[model samples]
Target chain A: MLKIKNLFLKKDNFILGKISFEIEKNSYCVILGKTGSGKTMLLESIAGIQNPEGNLYFDGKDISNISPNKRDFGFVYQDFALFPNMSVEKNIKFSARYKKIEDEKNLFLDLIEFLQIKDILKRDIKYLSGGEKQRVAIARAIYSRPKLLLLDEPLSAVDPTFRNSIMKSLKEIVQRYNTTIIHVTHNFREASYLADKIAVMLDGQILQIGDAKDVLNSPSSIEVAKFLGFKNIFSTKILGFEQKNKFFSIDPNKIDFLKEKCLDDYCFECKIEKIMGITDHYKIFATVKDTQSFFAKIPKQIFMELKLNEGDKSYIFINKKDVVFI
Target chain B: MKDKSFLIVFLFLGSIIVLFLMVPIMNLFYSVGVNNIFETLQDKETYESIFLTLKSSFFAVLFVCFTGIPLAYLIARYNFWGKSILESLLDIPVMVPHTAAGIALLISFNHGYIGDFLSFIGLEFIDTTIGIISAMMFLSAPFLINGAKEGFKKVDIKYEHVAQTLGASKLSVFLSISLPNAKNDILNGALMMWSRGLGEFGAVVIIAYHPMVAPVLIYDKFNNFGLKFSAPVAASMILVSICLFLSIRYINNKV
Candidate 1:
């Protein structure tokens, strides 16, 4: 397990303002954030590339004062900084030798076979493609058998078409090595696919942390919800409620379009304001009697069956189970 | 059409400069003639002076390489408090007049502190081959250091960091990665130092006029027997330097 507690780092104008998290062993934790949100700085601090002014423990051992090379963590930079003078095989062998591991040749061969870059072992680094270079860099990083792996925007440099395959390869390698990885990215799809637990970061602070679906479905704060593209959130007050909860949360997908529903505990009359077709689904926008506006995404076939149009009156239903109070 | 116009201008400028540079050297060869060149080569004194010039210059270049490469790498890689001051100090020898350089060396290595100490160890720098080599090194060492520093600066420091991460020691990285990358620049610096050493006259004449290098020999011959007697040796030295320069240029191109 990797634990960072009250980690504070101040350099120039950028600050990692009081970060704390625990990454369980062999779990893939993806940090999601916009640019200049301290995602890369946090990863660097974890890797021990730069010292932070707080406590960091790896598997219950303090590594706050450890040098980067001594931290036993593998780091993949965003640029895939391969040594230009060395061949692919030599580049992979460099870190292996640095860690003083025996059987370096066998390790090199294994990595080359795993990455499927055996054919280009003798080729110089400048000749490799983006994907190929990234594979070599990953191979070099993992060859030392580091306990922790840090990836700083690995797929951000590649083309969109190659991103999925590269990410899949990286995931497979990390699993095969049983390496605990802290992957950082700005892309939502990458975060959703890779993260067992997601930490949403903004402006040098982590706004929320939970399971990927949980964070996306119900964010902890307004800024986090908006950062995650939750478009229909509003400051609402409870009205005519027997259960005296302060607030309620609902997934737009779970809200049903009906006049009379027996299963739903909450119902409201709304007028359809706008309809938008979003690939394979329809996003319905509606206003609930001068209270607040909401959006519901439903499948295209189901939306066609309803034959809903703009300015049409409708009933929106929300089940109590779908409504989470936080 | 645009390329043709550029080509015409380039050729015109090139030919004018080439003619201006070659005419004086060609005049020496024309004066020596084919028969006189062979006759001059047959002389024992000509061979002796040529051999002395080559040997002393070779030693001077060797000394420059040993000291200059590391100093240049240090200046290029590290930022210290007095780095720019040290760099300017190195340029002082190159920019100062060679006659003043020889006078400075003479005063320092002449009598008391270092000179007498060295003389007690049977190494004197007065009217000896050592004096000639010392003079040449003083005038030429700056070329090697400046060239090598520029070369080292152009190499990416990330390569060294990567090597360090890979498990190589600092010395191993310098030898395998940095040295090989800077090979061309080192060779160029050596060639510059060697050429400068060969053409040294002002300092060599002031310090060691007895062990006559080719330049000093030519000067001596011109002073005693006029231009007619010195033309053959001058032409021979010019031809040798031109060939060496061209070969170095070719090697640089190949790299």
Candidate 2:
């Protein structure tokens, strides 16, 4: 297990404000946040690149004081950070010159083959394309067979079409090597698809961390909810609730359209304000009594069957349990 | 029509400056007969003077590799009090008059406690090869230092961070990553510094006029035997400079 306790790093105007978290052995934990949210800073601190104040323990050993080389963690930077002065093969084998590898030969062959980088091993780093560079960087990082691998925005540079394959390769690497990965990115899809545990960060603080579905389905604060793109977040008073300083969030996909007003506790009549077709689904923007607006994601088949139009009145139903009060 | 006239004026002015630079050097080569050039090349004194200039300048550059590169890297990577003042001070060597610089170096190392300490260690810079090297290094060091500083600054720190995380020591990262990435600039700087050292006259004349470097030898020939005698040696030095510079640049580019 990798544990971080009250890690604080202050550099000029930016501060990684008192972060604390833990990842179980071999788990893929992702730190999800927007730009300048201290995600990369937090990862660098964990990698021992920055001298962050607090305790960092890996496998019950205090590693806070250790140098980055002695800490034995592998890092893959967002820009690939491949040694442009060396060929791809030399870059992958760079760590071998410094530290001993238990199964060097087999690991090298496996990484090259698995990452589909066998042919580009002799080429210079500047010659590779974006996707190729990404693979080469990953192969280089995991070639050392580190116990902990820290990746910063690995998929950000990759094209959308290649992300799934890269994501799959990352997952397979985790399973193969049992390397605990702490991947940092802002994309929710990446976090949702690849993360076993997700830590939602905002303003240099981790607002929520839990299982991928739990954090995505129910955010802990308004900041995290907005960052996670929760559509139906509103003041509870708009829904006739007397709770002060409280807001509720309902998932757009969970709310449904009804033909008539149902007897559900959270049922209300709303006018269809706008219907936006998004790939395979349509987004329904509805306003309850022309005051409380909510967005619902309807499947294409359901949207076609309902034949909903703009300014049309319809009853929308929300399950009481789906309303997350924050 | 305005753009056309502007282009014509620019091209005409550019050609005039190019010719201004090229004409004197070309005329010197043209005036020196092939027989005179061959005679100067075969002259033992001229050959030794040129050799001394090349050797001393090269040693100066080698010494800078040890002293200047680390200082440049430190200045590039870190920020501390008086850093701006230190950077400005580094450029002072270039801005000062070379003869005055030689006088300063002479005084600091010749008459003071520094001279006593050096003399106690059986070392002296007066009219010695050490004097020649000191003069060259004092005047030409800014080229290499500034080049290295800018080169190191251009290299992203991410490379070093990634290397450390990959289990390489800080020294290893600097040697394998930082140094190699910044090499072109550093090499360019060294070349410029060596070139500047090869042509140095004022400082070298002040410190070591007896053991004549090529520039001092040319000056001596001009003063004693007029332009007719010095022209062959000067032309020879220029030829050597051009050949060496072109060859090194070609090799650096190929690598």
Q: Quick one: best lDDT, which candidate?
A: 2
Q: How displaced is residue A322 in candidate 2, in Å? A: 3.9
Note the residue pairs that clash in candidate 1. Answer: A94-B166, A95-B166, A98-B167
DockQ of each: 0.26, 0.89
Candidate 2, position A76, lDDT = 93
In candidate 2 chain B, where is summed lDDT lowest over 10 consecutive residues?
Answer: B33-42
lDDT of each residue in B123-197, candidate 2, tens digit only: 788898889999999999999999999999989999999999888888898999999999999999999999999
Interface RMSD (Å) of model 1?
3.0
Candidate 1 C-alpha lDDT tens digits along B1-255: 999999999999999999999898888798799688777867899878877888899899898788889899999998889998999999998899999999988887877878889888887888899999999999999898998998888777656654544445677778867877787888888888899999999888888998788998999999999999899988877777787789879977885
Model 1 C-alpha lDDT per residue in residues A1-326, reported as the tens digit of each score: 89899999998898896999898998888999998899988987887666788899998999998766677787777887787667888877777555676566677778888888999989989888888888888898888777888888888888789888877877786678878888998889998988888999999999888788898777787777667766555444533555533444567788778745344477788899999999999988888876688889888988888888998888888776777544
TM-score to true structure, per model: 0.77, 0.94
What local lDDT does model 1 show for residue B66? 81
How does chain B score by TM in each prediction?
A: 0.94, 0.96
Full-model lDDT for every candidate: 0.82, 0.92
Best by TM-score: 2
